[model samples]
Target: MNKLLLTLGFVLIPLLVIFALFMTNSVETQITLMCVALVTAIIIGFKAEAFKYDYTTFLFFLYLASFLGILCLIQFLFHVL
Candidate 1:
């Protein structure tokens, strides 16, 4: 179960986010996926860890996801400019 959750978090979510970013061409869809990814990361970040090492990865994921919305805005601005 732990491995499965980790795989979904580290692999699946990013894949979906990247796929949405390039494949949709819809800014709304891109933002929604990024929001979902951020929410998932937040859930993982807040879960009580079964092991000490768990927080390490979750923290990193949270850190990265926290910037996703800002990244979306920046990319939009770049394209507009």
Candidate 2:
């Protein structure tokens, strides 16, 4: 149960932050947040030992990194084209 809660927290906290950023209705802020999330995922992926062996934890960060990568790409396309 404790592990479950911790997993939920890893998912929910970012979702909540994204929710708040969406509420602001600022594209720049959203893009910035995405970049930050992507970097954070990378840092955590390398520095966190648990991510090395824990599949669930690895998936969570992988999901975060990929999702943020997509968002950043879309934002880049929007600005360039």
Candidate 3:
């Protein structure tokens, strides 16, 4: 169960996010952005673990916020520029 959650945390969640972004724009740029954010979250979560911090729950929230923030920023930028 732990391994499954970790895999979902590190892999499936990001894949779903990227899939959603692709569905939204069907553009390479949006896909790339989502992939980058996913990678960033994975790196951060791993780092927190390496440092022996109790970060699993917090990492999930952080990843979700970061994902939403990036999407919002992309939409805002597209509208503004």
Candidate 4:
């Protein structure tokens, strides 16, 4: 359960943040997400350490890759229509 929560924490938080950003009409979406990313990184880092996990940096980037891959897939599907 701990691992699952950690995984979801690292994955969903940023996506949720970005989704929130999309709801706004701000012209600085990139900057907003960047700030959200930094805050979420701190949160994930601290939580991972609290659970005595290792290879945090590796896992972060791996999660990021998976997230981006999903985003690309979604974009491709949209464009294919």
Residue-level error in angstroms, candidate 4, position 35 = 1.4
Off by over 4 Å in 3: 25-53, 56-60, 79-81
Q: Which sections of candidate 2 miss by over 4 Å?
A: 1-8, 11-17, 35-52
TM-score ranking, best first: 1, 2, 3, 4
For model 2 the local lDDT of residue 79 reads 62
- Off-target runs (Cα >4 Å) in candidate 4 are 50-53, 56-81
Clashes of each: 0, 0, 0, 0
For all predicted structures, in order, the TM-scores are 0.69, 0.47, 0.45, 0.41
In angstroms, the error of model 4 at 38 is: 3.2
**Whole-model lDDT, model 3:** 0.61
The residue-by-residue lDDT of candidate 4 on 10-38, one tens digit each, is 67666755774465444355345545665
Q: Model 1, which residues run further than 4 Å from truth?
A: 44-53
Question: For model 2, how does the per-residue alpha-carbon lDDT over 1-81 read when each residue is reduced to its tens digit?
Answer: 545545554565487557635664666777766666555554545554556667887787677667676766776677678
Candidate 3 RMSD computed on C-alpha atoms after optimal superposition onto the true structure:
7.7
Q: Comparing candidate 2 with candidate 3, which one achieves the higher TM-score?
A: 2
Score each candidate by Cα lDDT: 0.69, 0.62, 0.61, 0.58
Candidate 1 residue-wise lDDT, 22-46, digit = tens:
8877677888888887677556544
The model with the greatest lDDT is 1
Give per-residue lDDT, candidate 2, residue 12. Answer: 55
Query: After best superposition, candidate 3 residue 48: deviation in angstroms?
Result: 16
Clashing residue pairs, backbone N/CA/C < 3 A, model 2: none
Worst 10 residues of 2 by lDDT: 1-10
